[model samples]
Target: MKAKQIRLATRPNGMPTYETFKWTEETVADPAQGEVVLKSLYASVDPYMRGRMNDRKSYVEPYEVGEVIAGGVIAEVVMTNSTQFEVGDIVIGNLGWATHQIAHEDSLRKIDPSKGPLTNHLGILGMPGITAYFGLLDIGKPAAGETVVVSGAAGAVGTVVGQIAKIVGAKVVGIAGTEEKISYLKHELQFDEVVNYKSENFQEELKAACADGVDVYYDNVGGTVSDAVLRLINKYARIPVCGQIALYNLEKPDLGVRVQPNLLVNSALMKGFIVSDYGAHFEEAITDLAKWLKEGKLQSKETVLEGFEKLPEAFLGLFKGDNIGKYLVKIAEPSE
Candidate 1:
């Protein structure tokens, strides 16, 4: 079968443009023993992918120039030589940006559609949801009645973080870029306070909204936004550092306000972590997230762009704050 893949054409010094991606079409090889041929149904676009574009050492290896960009993908098995799966089995894996590709049985996890929507595997039930789960609960640990603030609060991770905080009985405060996001967080997600970071009086509004002081700060977008949140932290505040989308595209290093002093003075716990750090506890997190979702204690939102060709645009939309929640590209409908 002919398959299409998107490769990294060039690495960008700052924000990536259309020139960064190179599209190619090639024939897919037949599945070998213990392998399955996958037809992608959906793909995830996240802020963390920005760090992988650079040729630098990170928790995960960088995507080499001219190599296919890989991330969480939900697909349906079209052909299989593996005993573990049969044709029409839906699976999720860290696969390439291809319409179809071959993957080993061990590398793919079959999806139980009874749990939730297939797209949930790429969003709330998958990476972004699991990310918010461990980061906020394990690290931040927001207690009942305590104030929890989340930056980029309307995006994938941030939205889940805020909802989870509310589930635990915390007063959730969200900081997003647009009015639509602010309204959604405040009205739909029931966040106690939602501040627009782009507002001219952002710091003032944030201060007013977080009048009780922040007990837990889920830092997703670092930079001046974090600088302000740090100032309002209460004694013994907990901070879980997730993504730094604000500084990811900068050509030069951001010399923002040093965070050490606030952490020192407030006796705050600030730790940065990637989702893989808690790989051993993924099942635990997923179970709780799935339960909350089923109970209506947690809400999942997605911004989907139709077609495989929209992958790059959906990815770039993440940095532009064009999405209200998880951004996804729907490539095709499952043949089953």
Candidate 2:
């Protein structure tokens, strides 16, 4: 069968545009004894995938120019030679941007749709949720009644961070760009305080909202936004550096306020981490998240763009802050 794919056309110098991706068609090879043919169902677009576009050394290898761009994907087993899976079984994995492909059984995890929507596997109960769990619980250990501030508080990981913080009894304050997002975070998500970072009085607003000082800072967007939040750290505060979305697209270094003094005066602990850092504890984290979701203690919101061709657009929109909660692209539905 012929499959469509999105590949990295070139290493982006700044913000990646549509031109940065190349779409092509290829014939999928038949499955071998241990493999199965996968029909794409849903694909996830995240801020971290942008980091992979650049040709630099990081936790994960950079995407080669002219190679398929791969990330978390939900797919259905269309043809299988493996006993672990049968045709029409839905699964999730680190798959390519292609509409169809062949993968070994070990590379995929079968999904239990009864637990939640299939899309949730790529959002709340998947990478983003797990990232929020470890980053907040393991690093920014928020105590009851303490102030917890999260930048990029409306995005995939940020939303989860704020919700999980509230679950732990912390007072949650969210920093976002648009008024709509601010409203949603404040009213819908029940955040204690929501500040619009794009407002002229952002610093003033944030200071007022976090008058008691920030005990836990979930830094998803690094840059001026993070600079503002870092200034309000309480003594012995903990900061979990998750994503630097604002700085990811910069062609040159972004020099801002020095943060060492803030850390020094407060004797705070600041650490950077990728979700994979807590891979060993994913099962536990997922169990807790799923339980919260089932009990209505946790809510998930997703912005989905239909069609496989919209993958690049959905991804580029992340830098533009075009989504709230989790952003996903629905490629196809499972036949089963």
Candidate 3:
């Protein structure tokens, strides 16, 4: 079988561009024993993938300059030699930018589509959801009647953080870029308050929204936005640094207000975490999230683009804040 994959053409200085990627086709060998050929159904494009594009040492190794860029993918088995999987079974794994892939059965988890849309496996029920669950519950630790504020509150992870805070009886406030995103967070998600960080009076608005003072701050976007939120933390506040999307594309170092003084004076606890930190408890978190989703207590939204060719475009849109909830690309459908 033939598959086209996206590859890194060059290391990105900051925000990646069309010139940063190259597309190529490869011949996929037939599945060997214990292996399967997968047709990509849906795949996710996230902010973390941006970090991988940079030639830097981080939690994960950088994507090799000439190899295929890989991430979360939901696929269907087209051919299988393993008894554990059937020809038509849907599966999930850390796969490639290609439309099809060959993988060992152990590498993929069978998906039960009855739980939700298969795309959910790449979104609300996948990495972004897990990231929100642990980062907010374990780190932010919002309590009833306390104030919880999330920057990038309209994003995939940020939206879920706010909803979960409300579930735990916290007053949820969200800071986002556009009025539309702000409206979705406030009106659709029922967030207690929403602030437009791009507004001229952003600091004032956030101050007024958090009049009771922030008890838990979920920092998805660092840099200036985080700087503003840090200034308003109450004594013993909790800040979980999820991702600094604002700083990911920087071509140069961003020097700004030092945060040590703020953390020192407020006696706040600030920690950075990746979702895998709670891998042992993923089942517990996913079960709870699934329950809430089934009961309509939790809602998920997504910006889905069609076709394999749109993968790069979809990823580029993430930094521009083009999507609501989770962003995904639908590559193909199962023949079965």
Regions of candidate 2 where Cα sits further than 4 Å from its true position: none
- In the range 144-224, model 2's lDDT, one tens digit per residue, is 999999999998888999999999899999999998999899889999999999999999999999999999999999999
- How many residue pairs clash in model 3? 0
Candidate 3: residue pairs that collide: none
* lDDT values, one for every candidate: 0.93, 0.93, 0.91
Model 1: lowest-lDDT 10 consecutive positions: 116-125
> What's each prediction's TM-score?
0.99, 0.98, 0.98
Residue-level lDDT of model 1, residues 162-281, one tens digit each, is 999998999999999999999999999999999999999999999999989999999999999999999999999999999899999999999998889888999899999999999999
User: Where is the poorest 10-residue window by lDDT in model 2?
Assistant: 327-336
lDDT, candidate 2, residue 252?
94
